[model samples]
Target: MGKPTGFMEYKREKTKEQPPLERILNWNEYASRLSDESLQTQGARCMDCATPFCHMGIEVRGAAAGCPIQNVIPEWNDLVYKGKWQEALQRLHMTNNFPEFTGRVCPAPCEGSCTLGINEPSVAIKSIERSIIDKGFENNWIVPRIPSHRTGKKIAIVGSGPAGLAAADQLNQKGHSVTVYERADRPGGLLMYGIPNMKLEKEVVERRVNLLQQEGIDFVLNTEVGVDITGEQLKNEYDAVILCVGAQKQRALHIEGSESEGVHLAMDYLTGVTQSLLDSKFKDGKALNVKGKDVIVIGGGDTGADCVATAIRQEARSVYQFGKHPELPKVRTDETPWPQDPNVYKLDYAYEEVAAVKGRDPREYCIQTKKIVKDKNGRVKELHTIQMEKVLGEDGFYYFKELPGTEKIWPAQYVFVAIGFEGVENKIADHFGVNLVRNRIQASIKDFATNVPGVFVAGDARRGQSLVVWAIKEGRAVAASVEEFLTTSVKA
Candidate 1:
């Protein structure tokens, strides 16, 4: 929509990062920003399709596709192309509340479903998005949007993650008095704790939160709803309550010797290290210093990769990651095709960092940790492992089969379990008396309303543990339901 021939004039490109070797030395963001000139060119390649599937956000193959919050992709791309950065920022804020987090971390499926991607590489939507907001901040365009008057309606949000933030942002825009409660010392939920600052600088999170505070929204930190305040009290105090408490329970290892010291959850390890780095406080000497220690991370998901990279930064003597499944292919498979999440091998920042520091990938596929062994001091000494085959278990659940005589032991000073999460925690669910279908809060993706009339759930709590983008989507969707409920109540 910028220049008629803009698509033809530009080629798909993005900002390159500081080499992994150089980036691992500091706990800062790795990717370098695209220059203003290059950003304009990339944005111009948006193509402006009549039917922009990039923002359509479909449910193809029973799984969601495209942008979840329904980001106005093409419109903003065109604005950036025309050098209207401030205007682009306005258009972006029409839906998403935190482009800073998503632009950096989101796996841009919006680009995948782009019509342009059917033939050529999709527009650099994520990069363009980051540029617009960055430019807005530089020009002093991002300021608090205080509502002219209050509606006298009070609302309580149960979490401070992206979903909670999005719902609070929208509800505040409706002139409702909004308060967000977080159990953590700092808000931003997992963004402030679970994710490493090296990947996403903490100041970025603070910058947005500061702006929110200036906008008159109240944030009550270190107070959990179920603990500090009862669910019934919240319902009584506020006109409505939105539950954004994310999945906090981690899927754990079932192997023998699980109680051994030096074995910890992946989230626990990352949280301790990041908190220590922030407060300059270490555990006795240092926060899980892996220097000169051999490490084995026991999962293949994003958390596992994060452990691998974090271990390298701690200067571990050696690190190895075990994956239960077989190695993925380099290209998309039949089960996951174009426009769908590709079931392929891709190096995340942590894996890339580990490979850069250690001179190898450090990942072993089709292997499972059978048991852990501890030394006389009760610290983990080694891991017994073997390759496994895919088969049905006696319990009727499919599991990996260990081949006989394939057992091997490797010295391991530390073992971090990076497996995925279960559903929302049972304590809070039981306390609220909310029912769950499959560990997830019982609610449709379209409407996150629980059986309780005034209660709503969102984010990883509603969709199981998922990407940040999906959290935003669920938050916005739940906002619609909340708004409708509020309007109906007012009329009655």
Candidate 2:
């Protein structure tokens, strides 16, 4: 729709990034925006297929296959190509409330499902999206839309993460009084703490939260729902309640020295560093400092990469990342075919820094931590690891097989476990009397309504840990459900 021959004319290109070594010197965003001409060229590459799978918003193998928010990719791509940036921004907002967050953090599943990607590189959809919203902010196109009339209904959103914020935004737009509760000192939940600043700056999150405040939504910080206030009080006070509390129970590492002073959870390490950076700009030395120390990061995911980057920034003497699974193929394999999210190898920003400064990548594949040896003072001093191989089991599945004579030990002064999370904490769910299926809150897929009347669930609390895009999608959908429930209940 952008241009019939646009795909044939323009090749795919993305924004450039600062050199890894130069970027590692500070805690700021490394990727720079592309020029207008280049962005327009990238937008022109959209084929606008008869059936654009890029915005279908389906799930494949527990991962998003396309834009979960079902963004109007082709329409905005056309507007950007024609230099109608404001119009492009308008189209973007129709589906997504905060494109800035998704633009920075989303893995760009839309590109993976692009029709052009069937053969050549896909159109630069994510970059175009980032440019459009950033341009909107520059031109002052984003502003609070205060509802003219009130519905005389109140909604309580427990958790200020993406899901809770999105739900609050939608409900407020419909003229309902909405309040968001955050247990942290600040709002934005994972966006504010769990993620490091280098990947997504804290100010970016604050900007959106500020706009929500101006739009008539109330935010109560440092107040948890189940603890500070009784569940009965919330149920009696509000017309309806929505739980967006994230699944943040970090999985425990049962290794020998897990409780050592120097061993910490990845979330705690990241949160402490970010909080200290915000509070005193790191001058207070309140955060975990790993300077001149050997660091070991367990589990190889985005969180592990972030931990590695953070330690490097803190001037760690050395950093090592251990991944249980073997490295994936550089190219897409038959296991993950075309038009799906491929499990191909990629050098994320943090790993790039490790390679640049250390003169080699620090990842060790097919490895498992056996124990964390502690010094006399109860601090981690060494990490024992074992090499692993894949072996077929009786169930006809391949599993990690520990090799007999491949034990090794490395000097480690600090250890960060970045394995993952278990599920939503049971306290809040039990307090609210909501059922749990496999530790996740049980809510009907049809309308997000829980087993208890007028109680709803969304995002990680309901669906387990997932992408930010999915959280936003769930937020919007759950808002509609709340609206329907309110209307029908009133009529009855």
The sequence of per-residue lDDT tens digits that candidate 2 reaches over residues 154-211 is 9999999999999999999999999998999999999999889988899989999999
lDDT of 1: 0.83
For this target, which candidate reaches the highest lDDT against the unseen true structure?
2
Which regions in candidate 2 have their CA more than 4 angstroms from the true location?
392-394, 490-492
* True lDDT of residue 239, candidate 2: 86
Q: What is the TM-score of each candidate against the true structure?
A: 0.93, 0.98
Q: Candidate 1: worst 10 consecutive residues by lDDT?
A: 279-288
Candidate 2: global Cα-lDDT?
A: 0.91
User: What ranges in model 1 sit over 4 Å off?
Assistant: 2-9, 61-63, 281-286, 389-401, 490-492
